[model samples]
Target: MTERIRHDGIVVVGAGLAGLTAALAAAPARVLVLTEAPLNAGCSSAWAQGGMAAALSPDDAPELHAADTVAAGAGLVNAAMARLLAEEGPAAVRALADLGAPFDRTESGAFAQSLEAAHGKARVARVKGDQAGRAIMEAVSVAVLAAPHVQVRTGAKLTGLLQEESGRIRGVLALIDGRPVEITARAVVLATGGVGGLYAITTTPAELKGEGLGLAALAGARIADPEFVQFHPTAIDIARDPAPLATEALRGEGAVLVNADGERFMDRYHPAGELAPRDVVARAIHAEREAGRGAFLDAREAAGKHFPDEFPTVFAACLSGGVDPRKQPIPVTPACHYHMGGIATDADGATSLPGLFAAGECASTGVHGANRLASNSLLEAAVFGARAGRAAATQNDAKGPFTAVTAAELPPVALQALREAMSRDAGVIRDAAGLTRLLDLIDALEAAHGRSAPLVAARLVAACALARRESRGGHFRADFPGRAEPVRTVVTLPALERPGLRFAAE
Candidate 1:
């Protein structure tokens, strides 16, 4: 059976920093915001530890920020978007502060700044060390709930997008309280975060499995650099399934990376050592683990006295693992964290399909290319989220009387196996053999599970990873150890033909 539900104005999915920004920008445009979880619970924005990167300090400039972004991107960023984000980031940060975000400021009332992995200057504006995400989301959520024109619905999970015969996106299909329903809106924006959930050990909430990217691709939107997945180097290696993150900011504060033998090893990988780019650092840690060296973040010697106030979350996580940060190094491992690729969008967050837009970690606006620079994710979300919302609100359309489709059924056990396959094979490490094997398994699972949302997300990730042959940034290949000439690997759904699992010799 099929059911239809109609909504007026712009429809925003995900309710994170980007979604809230979109709602605020679309004010007086009458927005309907939907979230899968209670607004602040599972969204990645609230889990962000490092703060927004902007040219807020007197010694910093947007051009410097842009250059750092380009360097981290490994030569794949759109110069225009990088410039725009850098130039406009300060104003956005200021606006959030005005909305009561309570950003940490210096004694002189200037925004306090810190440096992360690839940034050249102390340009990251934070709040109380690692409380930026919680603080920012708290401020945004208050404004969103108080807004007269925004209606937010909790427990609304997106199943797919609704598109017309002409290939234009009209609205979305959602699972509201377990009942499938269709929503026709004037415009639709996807702020559904990233694909961190696809991994067995990740820093993102378990519900976000590249759903936004799959929806956009199925709707015939261009998908860019779907192979680029950023792995944060130091997730606390505890018994937790989705491991707790040890923020990169700790390294910026001089925490050292040591082996089980208490010897610092990052020095051999890069001269900057603990201060190297995330991809390099992650690989070093992975190599250590592979060699049975056992990696650990020795924060005790440096920030032990400041653990409770400086990094409460990390302190608590270490406590849960039966290790006190005040006395010992925490067991660490590289965990899948952020996705640098997603549904392709322009500077204003418009996709090729009319009435459809994307922002935040789910949209590839060329700000983060092969690898995203640390702390830039939040900046991109606020900057582009506002643009997306304003553009979507101004757009007008009447989706003809909505028609719903019967969803294909699936068997439960088959679905679990598919999730396991994706987590194991397409995870942090990859090579031609594993990817090919994973694609074959995905084909089998799709045949059994049918073309549901989860299957779609899995297939797209596997296919795109298979198609991108070179090793770059987060997409590492043991076989191909260096980056090939950089070009965005753009993909389109339904145009792909799954070749049988076989790899020719290089």
Candidate 2:
């Protein structure tokens, strides 16, 4: 039995930074926000500890920011997209301020800046060291509630996308309080976050298992760069299911990466050592743990005395876990943090299918390329989220000949086993045999349980990683540890097949 609910306004899914920003920006037009969690609870935007990146300092500029962004992208970055993010980032930060976001300021009343890896200058705008994400979301949530044009409904889980026969997306099918309902709208924006939850050791919210990316692809949208999953180098390893992050700002402040014996080890892996690119640092930490050396982030000498004042979040996390940063080095490991690829979108957040726009971690706009520059995720969400909002508001697709859609069922599989498989075979490092084994498991799961969203999303990543045969960015291949031609991997549901991979069923 299916129930239809018609909404004449733009429908935005996932009430994170992007969705909230879009709802506020789509002024004069009615907006409906459907979220799986209250406000920012399950959204990655609220989990971000590092501040947004922008060329706000007197010594920095957009070109410098774009240059560093290109360098970190490892050859696949689109120069134009990178330039746009750098150019619009400053104004976006100021706009957040106008919305009452309390950004930290220097003694001179200018926005304070801090340096991160791969950046040439000090230009990350923060708030109370690591409270930037929480502060910004608090301000944005207040604004969303006050906006007369927006209506928010929390705890709505998306199941499918509604698309007309003419390739125009109408709205979505969701489960609200466990009852299936179809909500049709003039336009739909997928701002759902990343696939970090697919791995057992992750820094993202556990429920973000690439639902938006999978649902969009199932509806025939093009997926881009699905293989590139960036692992943050230093997640606090205290046996927590979803690990707490040790922000990269600690490295920027001169913290060292050492082993169980307190010997600094990053220098042997890269010339830049602690300040190396994220992929390099993650790989180094992975290597250390693999060799039975154990790994820790020694922030005692760097931000120890200033712990509470400089990084209250990390301080509190450590204190709760019974580790004192001022006295001892914190145990750390590489954990799945962000996905650099998702449903492919253009500059204005338009997907290949009409009337569907995307922003934030769910959309791959080619700005992050092979690897993301540190602290750029928040900026991308705000700048592009607003753009997608305005574009969706003017959509005339409301006149569409809408189609009847059936909701996809959750696949029955061993969830814990699947996550352990991904972490063992697909985390930090990879090889052909491991990826092939992963695909074989996926093939059997799909064959027996039908195509589930989480399985489809995981298969998209593993299959693409197998096809990409060389090491690049976060998708490292131990068998082919080198770079190839810089072509981005783009695919649809039908195109993501592994004809060459073979494995015996368990």
Candidate 3:
């Protein structure tokens, strides 16, 4: 059975912080929000524990926050964007608080802040220590439900983009309960999360297989800096598919990374020890684990007695996995955590494609250049998601009537193969041969099983990784051992998929 309904409302493709914020910001304009998971489930936004970074303290300032962001980004960060995010971040935090988010507060009613890695001061605003994301999302979800202009539909996954022959976005095709439905939308926002599921070990939701990024790219949107994927150094090494994160705040609180010999190893790699940039920490852990010396995070001294209260989420996850953080050293590994590259967008979250805007993890706003500063993900979502939503809401035009196509599902075997290849080739530590091998495998999979969303996204990452010949930030190439000139990588689908494309660095 086919159902056709036309409305002048905007269509928001994700239900995370960005999508929800966009929907709220659109105000009285009608919005139709679609999500594959239930409102708060399967989104990286809800799993965040480090809280949002903002210059809310009296001693802190936006300029300092922006400086730390630029430094951690490893030279590719746009100075203006960093400054914008830092300056506007406190407002976003306040807005979330006004919407009923229960952020932790001091006795004097100021935001109770905690320090995170890379930040110059105590600026990360938390909620009961580690409940910031859950609390904020819960508040936003409630606001969205009460808003008369926003209508939400869970379990509806985006399949493809509908476009006019003139190259303008017309609508979106999605899969709803095993059936295909097309919605003619005036403006579409892609807030779908990152491509962490592409890796074997990740701290992101396993269901987020880069569908949003792939769909946008397949529709011919420009992609930028696809190689920069941040690997969290302390994913709890429990036997979980998508590992649970041991928040970076632990390191800032004095947690030390020690190998099997009970040796504190990070001091030898960088002077900052446990507080170095994420990419540096991840590589250090990777090197330790690879050398047969298993790595562990001993949080016994840092917030030891207060573990349960300080970071309830981490404490619960650890106890459930049969390790108590107050005593035992928690096993840790570097896992895919965040993607710094995605469907390239402008300052206002407008993508290269007309009528399509992207925000959050799916869009590369250049706020995060190579490695993202700690706790910046939530800030970016709140700030830019509103921009994308407001921009999309202003666009009011429905495409001439057309049938919506159903999204194709990728086979399990093919999906598994692709994930393995990505973990092996385009992972935390990479080389030219591994990246090329990953590309060859992607080509083989696409040729055999057709173009799956995950494969398309994987190809973009591997292709870009192959082209970048530097060990900068999250994208560390052992073959090209040093950081060269910091020119950004911008590529189109056609350029990447060229028929005889012998991939070469730009």
Candidate number that wins on lDDT, 1 or 3: 3
What TM-score should be assigned to candidate 2?
0.97
**Between which residue pairs do clashes occur in model 3?**
none
What would the per-residue lDDT of candidate 3 be over residues 377-406, giving only the tens digit for each residue?
999999999988899888969556443323
Q: Write the per-residue lDDT of candidate 1 for residues 268-323, one digit (tens) a residue.
A: 99988998989899989999998999999999867888899988888988899898
Candidate 1 wrong stretches, greater than 4 Å: 1-3, 399-416, 498-506
Worst 10 residues of 2 by lDDT: 497-506
Task: Estimate the TM-score for candidate 3.
Answer: 0.97
| TM-score of candidate 1 versus the correct structure, residues matched by position | 0.95
Model 2: runs farther than 4 Å from truth? 404-407, 411-413, 498-506
Top TM-score prediction, candidate number: 3
* TM-scores, all models, native as reference: 0.95, 0.97, 0.97
Candidate 2, residue 478: CA error in Å? Answer: 0.1
lDDT of 1 at 60: 87
lDDT of each: 0.85, 0.88, 0.89
